[model samples]
Target: MSEPWTLHPDRALPADPATRDLAREIYAATKDLPLVSMHGHVPVEWFAQDTSFGDPAQLFVVPDHYLTRMLVSQGETLPRLGVGSTADEAVETDPREIWRRFCAGWKHFRGTPTRYWLEHELVEIFGVTQRPSAETADAIYDQVAARIAEPDFRPRALLDRFRIEVIATTDPAWATLDDHAKLAADGYGERVLPTFRPDPLLHPDRPTWREDLERLAAASGVDVSSYDGYLEALRTQRERFVAAGARATDHGHLFADTTPLDDAEARRVFDAALAGTVTAAEAQAFSGHMLFQMAAMSAEDGLVMQLHPGVLRDHASAPFAAFGPDKGYDIPVVTEFTRSLRPVLDAFGHHPRFRMIAFTVDEDVYSRELAPLAGVYPALRLGAPWWFLDAPDAMRRFREAATETAGFSNMSGFVDDTRAFCSIPARHDLARRVDAGYLARLVAEHRLDLDEALDTAVDLAYRLPLAAYERR
Candidate 1:
């Protein structure tokens, strides 16, 4: 056994004395609040099955894209990292060896947020004092493996231990949600909910667009060969998700472009897409049109809409082909929200019932575009910094940039959009500490009252994310 390791106070703040002291004070106030994860990609199977996790590597390394992507970047095959479609693949099987490999390469993540979260997981969750290294790999692996075998280390058990009040997992519109159904039946209803992400069904540029459309039609009991039928089918899926306790719908698009095409043009584009002949421009236009229609439907159904746009997904073709989407090859690109969102903003920006949370990979937009748009539009609110931007520096930068244009009220609070269940607490803890650091600076400068800063800290930690995603 090793001596206990603990996170240093002011772990994520600048080294400057004033900011570091303020950050420490702020962190102390909000570190224990209940976590409310508004959006994430964790499969619901773990909670549904309620099975004991197998090993340290299988539990942490295999399911984390961040870990796998880092290893792959250094010419390490993902299969050797225990990432494969099925368990039958021949690769390194010993959990200790895998941990050793990861530990050997741990220096690759030294300055990254992954290092921060992994350290938290190691010290706080696994009770390891020494940093992960080749010398400590076997002992660390054994300890984590032993801890996971405990009855209280299961997914639901960890949820309670982590103090997660609500965790929303993203699900595609075409999904049957049988896993969520099983969870609800097993009585984890209040803790886990689904967010409907309708991208695959809307992106006509995808290779299996028509096939996915067919699947949607079959699943929703509608004939989706035509544009109107497709819209109806989407509405049916939304209704199913609503019945399953979904309060929001998420859209991941290359751009925030929105178009309100007339019925004739929409039908024409749908026919072309169905025939595998829609050009890139036409497909984009069609997707934009669907976005508007979806917003109108959201107005009627009361599901909050989330637009996470301007991500250049699958940028590295070879890795994407071999490993599939979300292999950490996604890159941020400049986005023009002001022009791209004109159509949707014109149609629904003033509607009180229509709520759209805007997220971006483009940090420049937080201050210049998204904040201003969200500030003025009654329907719009700024989502937390996402993906690559979820780090402590990005969170603080987002607050500094956007709070001037769109007050804290116009921005939804932090969300741990993570798949690693154990990392949930660590991610939220980082966000809270960073947020508190931000507020503490405001206090130190006398820009905000101590009482107000404290209240805002609590809201950022708990209330805001729940209110943003949970239907009003």
Candidate 2:
């Protein structure tokens, strides 16, 4: 049998011996920097409660769409992986069985970022010695379970172990933030922060729109019976997030269009939505207008605006119907930001307090649209490769394509946009290595001095995120 799982120290570095040496130095310098996670989807309750991380399957398999989607593509049912579409659905109940299924299909994740992160978690976090497979699954599961039983394995303790200086968890606009309040009272509010996410309230076409509006009204204590009242409720919720130490607002819309409708038009559309008579086209327009409003509000409030566009959430109906959203069905569609964002960009793109980071899964826009748009706009910067494109090769391509036009300063250092809490360090470590390799190539080519490359590497890994996520 092959040797037990081991990660090479030089993995993800440049291939050439000379360039690889330079990258090694850079990576060594950057590999241990304090983690500053400004944008992510980590569950807030983990740190708020500071509880044990449960079993191996629950930690690594159940909630990870990246793992489940690949297994699903290989013809394994989600239910067999313990991911039933609904609570009442008949599914695998044994965590060991789920672990076996994941381990047996381990080969399917070859060459993917999921493999890189999982291996890091297994080896570095859990002291796992064997590569996952049906044969080794039981042994590894026992090892991980023992580690989870340790007091140091709690979520808050892992934050210290992972060297995370600060992390922002995505929260709905109307969220009570009770968990966040708990963390704040425990004196970790600054380390574990909330991020305002108002996507649901902005999408009036959604089946749950009215229901979400009522929730917003109740949470914000603002009546949403009128269009102006709805706006006030959103603003009020944003203030609540700011009070909870939120540094940013996150939007994952399907389009980048941010054209503002006149107040009359906006009110008319909102009224139509309330009356249940809004057309699909009006709903889309209203969503775009809301984006404009979000940008405007960010300009006033100084919360960094994070815009992620061009995703068709839940592309497959069967799995979605069975397992619900974010079970790896979200797929990327073509996105254009240059023309689509002109309305908002023209207005706030130069505003001193307006700061925006544009993230897209569409690599085509890295050089053509986003880079140039961010290059000239004082308020805009290109975010790191996100979602489907956060892999090593995609990250390298992002630096290559966008750096020419936007340059390094205009890029938001690596934003680890993930929902998996344990994978945070792994994700950042991978980014640092990819960036070290990229900067090493530049140094070897005489395009940059080693000193300059080293400084830039630190910026990409540490300083840039602090600045990017800082209030402008």
Backbone clashes in each candidate structure, one number apiece?
0, 2
The model with the greatest TM-score is 2
Structure candidate 2, residue pairs in collision: 85-322, 85-323
Task: State the lDDT of candidate 2 residue by residue for 366-439, as single tens digits.
Answer: 89999999899999989999878989999999999999899899988987888888899999999999999999
Off by over 4 Å in 1: 1-5, 14-21, 85-94
Candidate 2 ranges beyond 4 A from true positions? 85-89
What's the TM-score of every candidate structure? Answer: 0.95, 0.98
Which of the numbered candidates is closest to the native, going by highest lDDT?
Answer: 2
RMSD of each: 2.3, 1.3
Candidate 2 C-alpha error for residue 31, in Å: 0.7
